[model samples]
Target: MSTFGKLFRVTTFGESHCKGVGAIIDGAPPGMELTENDIQPQLTRRRPGQSKLTTPRDEKDKVTILSGTEYGITLGTPIGLQVPNLDQRPHDYGEMDIYPRPSHADWTYLQKYGLKASSGGGRASARETIGRVAGGAIAQKYLKLTNNVEIVAFVSSVGKVAMPFVHELEDEEPVSAEFYDMLNNISQEEVDKDITRCPHPETAEKMKETIMQKSAEKDSIGGTVTCVIRNCPVGLGEPCFDKLEAVMAHAMLSIPATKGFEFGSGFQGTKIPGHLHNDAFVRKEDGTLGTKTNNSGGVQGGITNGENIYFRVAFKPAATISKDQETASYDGAWGTLAAKGRHDPCVAPRAVPIVEAMAALVIMDSFLQQQARKASAALLPSVEIHHSLLGVPPKK
Candidate 1:
């Protein structure tokens, strides 16, 4: 479970309060410009204490490129990356050596392993995602440079506060050119404009206030993040088992606090009939066959259709709250415990980058798989078989 992706695969290691945490990325092409500079930005974005709403851990999360590069270019080998833990206070969690936090992975980890870390959630900590963010940065750079793919995720809701829908497309028509413009070209700078990172200024303000209020009350809240993957090539996914959306959901739900995932019309699409839910094929201005409606998101029949792919992930509130709660200990002892640790009052804001990182991982793997399929199909020249097997047009 610690490893993710296939070809461009990533295996993340280390723990929350350990000396460091990082990832080893394999299958990257040689001679690509790579360095600490490319990875640090995403780590900083995912780090704690960026705002008062998040945990006040204050980790710099400075990453180091330990291997797989020389003179700032990749060597087509396994890349080893590390980020140190600068502000670890494991002693603060001594109370948890005996009693686990309610709703946290503490008990689960112990139950599975027969023992657990002395402090922090160990591998289950959000810090573990540091490696993912770093590795995903590489994937993002490659996808952007090669396919012009743009992946952006933002806080769509915090607690009960939510932004006004960015786009409310009708079933009769596809996403407008205006929406593609806004969604495709959106920058992380815009999403980070507010403390809550909700994109909508008014809603961001409300979300921040709600988070502050909850933190003050020693409570927490759950919310949602919306992500968009624009300018993706068509035909990325296995038709039978690894449907594009299914793999996407697998990736998103793997996140620590993620509770739910929905893409395209998702659950709401069920409200409409088959005709209305379907995305009709039409010709784009570029002469490529496209969808007149995009209720299928950007994928049809488990494959991408060269349109914007969008999804939403719901996050449960951080389980470690400062408020006291009664729960069972490892030995079946029941007592009141007020969790002692730094945790987000609402996870949506910091989770924005993680959502993007996970999305990048998925897209990167899909892109590589598609590339492999296309390359192998080139040697076989039966026209009918080629068309059937290589459903997507060859890369121009």
Candidate 2:
């Protein structure tokens, strides 16, 4: 199904080469203040041609709201949003009609649908993510107001450049002008700016030089993104069927090029013994039990533990590159096709917003689920309280 969610529903539409693509969001709460301005920054971040390392395709990615609001606030109705296609190169993809790009959806799409968008991979294009990003921004606003939860994701790796380990940034703190100053002050022409977007000048310079050289050679590469969620309330998930992390992984894997995802210790935990990997219980100043180490990544028993949750997503290289390669056409004839389009040498930079959007969606969904569960529990005659869990009062 193209739709997601039980309470805050999101349904996406349109194709990459179509006039435009958009989404309709239903079940958004009323009176939660929102504006087109709030959604623009995210769309801009995902827009094409934002930097030298990304595709040269220029798109303004302007969003228009068609319904579900009067003035600026949402009406608690289905919200409709549209993004017009400003820069389309339909002719540029004519060759692709016969020869599909490797590692892309071209061949599989034709196999499944018997037809594919002649230009820009249509529905499969990363352009389709505009709806996701816009819808996610709304979810994020709601999540912030309800739980004060914050989600931040940045480039953690690009090609070979890996960022040194650093404490995750807090979400409650607003990114100040100083932060913008730091980003603007970066001297490298390429956007990777060190695998982690860490703003280390020397590393950024080398990272840029490397991407430029690769771009010039008509090759493409991929990397990883690490997302951190903070201040999320406890008891925010339904276990077994709808585990929080599983829902999150499903949403993330739906992205165009994501290849892998792991929460908490993930695969690295396998190397450590049970004692070393476990999160030890400790008494906080408030006398609440907390984990001294976050090896669990906040979620225990498929529920939030009121600790910072972090994970990593690995993105595969952009498949469309300038170099020639051998491939079979729709008629099963062996041939050569060189990618000819404005494409990114590395997609890691542009993917940051995409990752953040999915992360917000997961957290928001989990928070809503928590509310539903609490409401259901309140309806019961008796309840049980646990000393291990935070938030809420003991059952009376």
Candidate 3:
């Protein structure tokens, strides 16, 4: 389905080489200030040709607000946004008409629909995410205005070059103080300083070098993006099948070329026993409950705990490389395919905004869902129950 979210539904449309691409965003709060300017910054960040590491698609990605706003204020109706695809070159993908690119969506798309786009990856292209980034800009604005939520994502690793991490044997020790400090204070400006989008200076240089080497060889490399959501409202996710982390994983993995998702301790937690891994409850300066350790990633039992929600998303290398490869055609004929197209050697840098955008969408939807539940529950009369029957510890 093209739509996502229960309360804040978004339906994205258009293909890679289409006339344009955009999204229709429904359920945005009325009377809020909204304009193309609010959404353009993120789109510009996600656009290609920003650096030599990324594809040279040369899209301006200028967005236009078609409706759902009057005098720069949302009217509580569906918001229509569109971005023109100016630099499209369908001829570049002429070779793909016969042979499907390896490790790409080409074969599966053909099998599912019995037809496929003639140029580029069509819907599978990173260009498809333009709508997501646009919609997320609105949601992020609302979240910041209402709850002061802050979402930041940056390239944490490129290929084998990664920031330091605690090993299984070192699980007894918490994540490094430097790592925590970075999460607490990192900003988009700091992240964008380096083209790699890795806040750490040395690591960003190494990642840049790796990407340049891959581009020189007409190859591609993959990496991970780490995102942190701070000041998220408590009780933002369901306690069952729609656990906070579960939906987050679904959202992150939906991006093209994404292969893995993990939050908090994730797989590392498996090595530590329950006692050591459990996040102990503590009272904070705000007189609210908090966690002594954030092994739960600010979410426990499927709900936000008013702490920072952090996660990492892994994206595979760009499948369409300029190098020649041995592969079978649609008719099972063996041949050499020298893929011709503008493609990123390393997608992690470009993926930074996409990751933040998806995280905003997930958190925004969860926040609205919980708000609706609370509003309805508040209408009901209070019920008195025994402390033991409640199955929760008594308040201090």
Best by TM-score: 3
Q: lDDT (0-100) at residue 4 of candidate 1?
A: 92
Name the candidate that leads on lDDT.
3
**Per-candidate TM-score against the hidden true structure:** 0.93, 0.88, 0.96
Supply the global lDDT for candidate 1.
0.87
Segments of candidate 2 deviating more than 4 angstroms: 166-202, 381-396
Write one digit per residue (lDDT tens) for candidate 1, span 1-396.
Answer: 889988988899999999999999998889899989999989989999887888999899999999999999999999999999989999879889768888888888887998898899899899999988998999999999999989999888887677654434455333355544557677789988887877788888888888889999999999999899988988898797899999999999999998999888777676667876687789889988998767688988899988889888999999889998888776789888887889899998898999999999999999899999989988887565454465776655
- Which residue pairs come into collision in candidate 3? none
lDDT of 2: 0.77
What's the distance in Å from true for residue 224, model 3? Answer: 0.3
Question: What are the RMSDs of all candidates, in order?
Answer: 3.3, 6.0, 1.8
Error of 2 at 186 (Å): 17
* Candidate 2 per-residue lDDT over residues 1-396, each given as its tens digit: 668776777888988789998999988888977888988988987888887767889999999989999889889899999999978878888779778899899988888988888888777788888998999899878887887777767665667776544223233222223333333233223333344353555655666676788799998888787777777888887889788888888988998888999887777666667877777889989887888777677798888898777778888988888898898987889999887888888777788778878888777777776788889978999655574574657666
TM-score: model 1 vs. ground truth: 0.93
Off by over 4 Å in 1: 166-185, 381-396
lDDT against the true structure, per candidate, is 0.87, 0.77, 0.90
Backbone clashes for every candidate come to 0, 0, 0
